[model samples]
Target chain A: MSPTNATPPSERTRVRRVAQRGRYDRETLHAIVDAAYVCHVAFADEHGVHCIPTACWREGDHLYIHGSNGSRMLKLATHGAQICVTITHLDGLVLARSAFHHSMNYRSAVIYGVFDIVEGAAKAAALDTFVEKIAPGRSREVRPGDINELAATTVLRVAIDEAAAKIRTGGPRDDEADMTREVWAGVLPLAMRPRTPIIDAAPSGTPDYVRQWHEIASANAAV
Target chain B: MSPTNATPPSERTRVRRVAQRGRYDRETLHAIVDAAYVCHVAFADEHGVHCIPTACWREGDHLYIHGSNGSRMLKLATHGAQICVTITHLDGLVLARSAFHHSMNYRSAVIYGVFDIVEGAAKAAALDTFVEKIAPGRSREVRPGDINELAATTVLRVAIDEAAAKIRTGGPRDDEADMTREVWAGVLPLAMRPRTPIIDAAPSGTPDYVRQWHEIASANAAV
Candidate 1:
């Protein structure tokens, strides 16, 4: 199941240079977007082209990102405008035998589509998704958004249209001759580990969600 | 001091919304670009707009990025083309008392400029900078690029030109009223850690530079 509601690869999101890195499988799209906490979104304004990095969350078929209603990017995105949202995860640094072949083992996705403003029940649900994405059970632990708080937020959803995932994994690929060089070449795994959460005023210790995230990430690092 | 050769925020690179976070300081530019291993470069063709995330290096006032000569992004960036390069570092998750004020602490820079193709020894030097950027002394340890490797690669340099660094640090900024809520709110520090190097074949343990980086990062996390 490539795209249940896939936009298919148009000229927009196609991975041209390293075509092999381009993957359109449904799982690839979900995995790339879900793993990353933020995305660099690009769009054109009268000032040529611009890219802004913002927090994002991936829902079932749609990706949700919200901002202050007064913000310019949110205003423009909600008007059914075209935009490009790209998420990248630097997995490891590939140190090739030759400087020219040095590459990053990463997973990135670029999705292009128009946005629609989500409101009412859907808006509240999307907010939960955003919090939960940060930590599995975070949404329930935090105070729910009140009426005025929800009113101040502007949530936009973009269908996972024209999606593409570019990934590079494993060890360096050096020329057979260069492979034997004495120079050390290998992978330095790059990862984001959750640190100790700093609470403002906790009558009751650190939250369970934060602690769970910390433990899982710590365990992974030890292994 | 600001841009010595500042591209001056054209309507293009100008930070319109939340203008307070937009910075034009020279040190800010160097700090952000130098810290990241990759950048999302955006440009337009008849096909549409594209953003390809690739390895990038900062040397003096010029930002260097290279890829296969056949790559479309490198092709467009080489010949005095207009492009946007953005780098973002997600520092933490700001769990606020209210959802409306939920924000992330991050540092991001968006640079706008036209590209110039680097040639001769400058191209080779830029590759060295790229490797050194990954690990301070990595270039010397790795085998130097051969003539064929340099010939096959295309390097582009964009002047520091119009650049803006938007940053949000510290803890959550919650509404005064919401501050008294019973909900747990705080910052979960997000950091990227370099894991142990997976060496290909090193007669003497890992190189000093790689081990140094790992130790410094590990020590900081312990603090």
Candidate 2:
């Protein structure tokens, strides 16, 4: 369930002051999350605290995370407790004249909420959802998880609540007095593009599902 | 103070595994941390737990981290509490025959220890150490932090106690039976490289300190 205090529409987080560089809208946040593959999940434990970085996939307003059943974070989350989920994309390196001014241009989202473990049929469906998120349409192509494997894995669902997205983009903004200094200043965009797919070495024709999506991603990028 | 049981020579956390896919020796681990620019620091608090991804630098077996004086994690660490510091580099995607087998090749290290705040002159030294980690000789080239700025920042040090490094590299290992499958399978090397450095807009000749390290990182890559 979403928290009642989840960021209000107007209170949504954005890059303050640098209006041109921030995006507070939900669509922008979702697009950033959709394009990324992993997230850093942080939580506190009795023995201090820890953050675990792992792969994740989103469906609607909920995020699904999987880990070994023995993982401390997973064990804690399974008890229906609040956790922090952050997804960050480092867009570029901001080289400033001043070392103190040196910073990174990045897009990041922080979500805080209690997570509920998906069990029984719900767990099975969630796994399928994760499969499709990684490689669209591949969910149905592979053999489903067997009972033993499924029982051994843990999947936790965190409802999107009280989330804030912060971003910084564009060329370096040097101090006014330093504007005319003989220093180069511009942006070097960083993008993660999919390379040729590494097919598994097993014996079988390329799965139709994999081929279809590969073609789609290529076409989208070409545009 | 470090936890008595936490000082293991080699202890794998959730992300660290010794499987054929997740193994790294001490040299590889140290090299990865030395070259990394930022690390994801995770800690827990009364309002659940928080993970803030921030810049970090290491000296010997200890890591130095600084943040806004008001940061909750900084407040907690200053009390000499245990914390988790992690550095992760995502090398590339691992496309597998099945979606479940899909993974990312990465190099990561996790250290568990209690943090001690650096104050007075020791704090200034730590700041210099941080700069040197990023640009070996550049700390002296730039103006040191003044009283106000230094006062506004909080720095904490965590000794490397229980630590482990995990790495996944090389080409994909598909199922033996899938060897003849007409699917592509190989690694697409991923790397972070420096483009032309953008100088600040102010007029000053390139600092010799910055120029000296230009060629030092030609062979290294970031995750």
Candidate 3:
């Protein structure tokens, strides 16, 4: 109902002005995370901490991420325990004259919360959501997962409670004194777009749903 | 020098199969980490573990990463504690008919180690390595960081003792039964290429170093 507040927990996570290069509102944050198909998830354990890049999808206000059920990290994350999920898209390299100022322009989101494992019907529903997230209407076009396959997968749900999004997009920021130096400086905008789809050797009947979905995705230049 | 033999701590952290993808060899691991300009760092505190994506570069077997020196995670990491560092390049998205089988093809490296604050000359050297890692030859082109600028930055050195690299390339791997299904399946290879260089408004002579660097980069698309 009310506007969802997506604020950083502490001053450390709060982005500074120079580092804050784009809109930090909730809409922008959700849009970037939802549009992305893969997210690099990082978490801590008794042996220290580790991060792995994996695929993720959003369903409503929550995000569902999965990995092999045997994964120790996934097993630990399943008890509705608090964890951190981060998704990032590197836009470009900010080449500054000074090494200290050399940086990257990127869009990233950090979600801090407890993730509950989805099982039974909820699990099936979550899997469907994952499919639809990639291809809006392709879920119905393919056969559903069997019990054996589902048993090997683990899905954890993280509610969007405490979160923050930071983005930097633009040309390099050269110092006034160094501005006249003979060096190249400008933004090379990085974007992802869907290329020509490779239809299977034998397609059922080019599903109307897929056709319409790709049409809209192409129009929006989304991969 | 003999190759550095640093084994990633646990079995889960150790990469399996596809030896090229699982570069446990120190030379290979350091090369990949040095070439990358950004890393997704994951750590935990009172609010749970969180992952923040930022720019990073390596010098020797040690990695240098920076952020607000006052950051909670940074402060925690500076205690010579272990943390997770991951760098990934999403080469392509593998779109499959069934959602359960859908996956992304990418190259990713994960490192776990204690981070210590680099001071004095060590800090300055790390900074130069950071610049050279990103642009190869740009460090000499610009003014180096002064004491005041260096004071404002917080640089942590993560030694490469426990690390692993995993990569997946080529077309999609659909199940034999699902292979005949009527759906699109293949890779959309992602590649990054530098566009025309935009020389700074004010300039010195186009440095031979810069020109030669571009030639080498264009010749090899490894980065």
Candidate 4:
């Protein structure tokens, strides 16, 4: 259902530092986007370059974002301005025997491209994709966006063609001479954990998604 | 320990959409930075614009970043290129009664400025501050960076004068028309949680930081 193969890197997508950690395969890129709830998008305008964080989702080979029709970012993207979107998950802190060798365990994806305005039927369909992503069966329960509400919003998507994923895992790599130092070395892991759901109201029964949110997240972390 | 008051916003730092959520106080800015382990930096180069994620920490009224001297971002930053640094903590997903009103609860700080290179003793001291932030007393235990190691790294810091923080919390705000709909509405809260520490080696006893990592994080989340 996603991009099936890796694409050749463009001049901008090539990873220069720690090149071995770079990945170009679509599978790697898709997994990174799927795990994230938001991404930081960078763009340049008359004032200067700006980086803004916003909710994002993936469908096939494109990454989608929506905002008020008056949003400066959406307005700029609709004009075909180039932009960079990045998502990062900080997994842990890597502790080493030497200060110089300390590092972080993380998974990150960077995508570079221009966004195209999604309109008409496809725009409505895309909104459904986003709602379904956040709360599986709840999309059906919620009142769908009215014509006026949908008209007041803008939806945009960029192809995930020129993207790269970089990942670092495992323990710290300390110099041989420093390894014998009397220090406790290891990793202190971190995760985006789901907490107890705070219900505003539930005239209907709690859906499976809300009921199992914390349990599913805990199980995933254990793996 | 931080900027004492809120400063007037520059043209680029002002929040335009949903302006009520904007925050300008230094206390708010510093808290957002302190809670983050990383930030996405956006800078434009000859190749085009880029958004790169990197480790970051705060000290006084400045934010500091360090990297290998050969890093292109570091090299360009040292030359005084204008950049945008943004740190965001995703707190929860707000599920509204209607699809149009779904939103995310997050705390985000966006700073705009050029970075100044850090050198000599100040650079070394700043690195220690970073290490201390990650693991309180571990700085004294690890073998300090040697002269050569210090020479191979580049440190940079930017003034936090031109910055703004935006935050949203609690339950979703549904339109009156949609509120009576039969949808389970509220927030599905999320947090960056600490898992059990994984030890690679322990020649010395486990420090209080490592021993209390999960407990401390869990307590903070409860608040």
Candidate 5:
């Protein structure tokens, strides 16, 4: 996003705890949301709060999530209820000389808003966005959802009204006394990647987009 | 746990949607929670619902999470606020002939209960558990938290009364009509691994447990 289009902090979006780690920029939030494959959506009622993990994609300032018509989460969210969508990518494990200093290096984002259920032509376009965002150029290559399929699905999008991104990096910050100890302390890095593309019996070999993404992921994993 | 230690479903734990994916067994829930590095915790209040991602560990029927004493979620949860803790591990990406059939293979668990703040000796033991759990033997080798360090942290646990685990595996389940299309369809396996370990400048050589876990993670990625 342009500098002028950055997200501003709201009362609810402000990071009250560990305030130093919080980021209030649209670019940071967008990058985190776009790179993540799934998010945990939370909604509540008199019964209790429910946090459901589901796939999502970011397009512009909006985040789109879809589910079957029969999904309890989809049904509850479509009624214009408030929701919290959170995505966290664990980067590594922080090892410290003292137990209390142990932590993890990570990047996370939380978005707050009510979802608007897409319908008719808009829903179709949003579903297309989900597939295309998941894998570049694949949406144009594959068959789109049929009428029955579209009717049975529910797509919802929440515009970025309030959001915050938090990140932690670098090696462990051990205490001065503990740092002198002989125990080793540093980050044990963690990463996510596609293992390999399993081609179906179908005629097409692996598509370039898929293969290219896999290669890039594999290369990153190697370092 | 013994055969008699099964986790029976409570009123809220019963899987109302996609019932087939739900598992009420303690063994299943334990395995899913143990493998996950983080969980998205959901809670509601007069203001609204919030989802925060944080580190967690499961031991027996109890799940423990710790945060800075000033954390909003930790404070609310310590005061008997109802909370939902959900952990999800994305295993693979399912590519189907049609967009509607696209999905991901994952293992997830959500536990609902009130958190009890751990204190004194029990808090010390729990912090040890957190360390041992994250990297098994590292706790024994390192010094335990001192007075100030322990006082600065808040550890909380929720004994499981109602919990559910949902998992999806295997290849894409495309419709019979669409399966005949000349489209590649299957699962693109995804996994987590520790990148080359960054040995702290102070080292007794990388511990066997850490090295062994990295080797196993790398071996799995190779296949």
Candidate 6:
């Protein structure tokens, strides 16, 4: 499938609480997924519901995840078990004049669907996409996965068609009565900023991605 | 109950994959929870599995969450529904020499349990603890939740008894064969850093927490 033109492609995807903060567009969903390095996946079995965090990335209209072939999650998901994948980026801490109105600024996306295994040549390409996401040009530099290694990994993707994004930004919205309270109210803005890269035993010159990582974080932090 | 001296207290909480990375101690679980502002809660309903992100805080041996009384998750949880709460802190991107060995450095905690409601005085106190967590001494400066506001909210807590923490740190563990590959290998560390505080229309002087926000980020980033 492609980016959802209409929000809430399914009944379960509708946002009920704080409906004003909900976004059902593809752009919002993709942005949330792309910005995250990890996502929490929710699924159920006889033992009950489980929420596990795993590395994730987005390519076009699908969100991709990979793990060992023996992974409980991948094995269960391969069987077409219904699952929910969520990515949340906590942007800041919203402080209000009243404790009741305090909230956090965050961008969160929730996708509901079943994962389809990516096999054959697409699997290798998908793995490259993930590496490229982390460091451009480095995929070619690094030794590619061997046939045995590739066989041991399972890559799965879920369509972003049934997804909803909920975002909260800016300052706190205090009640009219509480606005006059003598309190320090504002947003303690936060971002996942990069520290100075800790380069390991590189066999050659540093990659462009590593060199620019701190720069990118500084640029984002300034915003 | 105190921190578990023995790990894998229950059958389900056991970490099956990469068992060496798992820690069942309470200290590990508490640190993960304390470091997170939000948690992804997985619960099953007629609509299927749902992973929702909500503001979370740790109060001693329990993880606390609150929402409007009409919240579906709160209502369902109030009824003793078994659920899973997960908190993950992505520390860095681990770029390995081989595509197959690529991984992420993170600290995560998964807790399986049923939520119990906090009522009366304990509920109010629990909310205060959350406020204090966000801003050390600001709880006194802000107007506390009124009776009406308190009545409209529901606070739920789950014991940290059945929990496991998985953490992976340092550089990537590349395969012996790939170790000689001429690739820039290392960690691009990332952290939730505080940007400059965005002060709203405050009626008084800046608080200590707001003042120290950026400094704290700098200190953490240096580490």
Which candidate leads in lDDT? Answer: 4
Better of 3 and 6 by TM-score: 6
Clash number by candidate, in order = 1, 17, 4, 0, 0, 0
Clashing pairs in 3: A180-B202, A182-B203, A182-B204, A203-B182
Each candidate's TM vs. the true structure? 0.92, 0.77, 0.81, 0.96, 0.94, 0.96
Q: Residue by residue across A68-126, what tens digits does model 2's lDDT show?
A: 78777788778766677878777656655444555677787777777888899988898
Regions more than 4 Å wrong, model 4: A1-4, A214-223, B1-4, B214-223
Q: Against the unseen true structure, what C-alpha lDDT does each candidate score?
A: 0.79, 0.64, 0.68, 0.91, 0.83, 0.89
Candidate 2 or 5, higher lDDT?
Answer: 5
Error of 1 at A152 (Å): 2.9
- Cα interface RMSD of each candidate: 2.4, 5.8, 5.4, 2.4, 2.2, 2.1
The CAPRI classification for model 4 reads as medium
B136-166, model 6: which lDDT tens digit per residue?
Answer: 9878988899999999999999999899998
Residue A125 C-alpha lDDT in model 6: 97
| Positional deviation of residue B129's Cα in model 3 after best superposition, in angstroms | 2.2
Interface quality of candidate 4 as DockQ:
0.67
- Model 6, which residues run further than 4 Å from truth? A1-4, A216-223, B1-4, B217-223
Candidates' RMSD to native: 2.7, 6.0, 5.0, 2.7, 2.5, 2.6
DockQ of 1: 0.56
Model 6 over residues A155-211: C-alpha lDDT tens digits? 999999899998899899999988788888889988888877878777798878988
Q: In model 4, how large is the Cα lDDT of residue B142?
A: 95
Interface RMSD for model 6 amounts to 2.1
Q: Which 10-residue window of candidate 6 chain A scores lowest in summed lDDT?
A: A1-10
DockQ, candidate no. 3: 0.34
lDDT of 4 by residue, B30-122 (tens): 999999999999999998899999999999999999999998899999999999999999999999999998999999999999999999999
Give me the runs in candidate 3 sitting further than 4 Å from their true place. A1-13, A16-24, A174-177, A180-183, A192-223, B1-12, B15-23, B192-202, B205-223
lDDT, candidate 4, A37-102, per-residue tens? 999999999999999999999999999999999889999989999999999999999999999999
For every candidate, what share of the true interface contacts is present? 0.58, 0.34, 0.41, 0.84, 0.74, 0.87
Residues B1-223, model 5: lDDT tens digits: 2344567777778787778877878888889888987989999877799999989987778888998898888888888988999999998888888888889999999899999888999998888888887888888988888898789899999876589888898888877888777777777788877776666645666787667756755553545
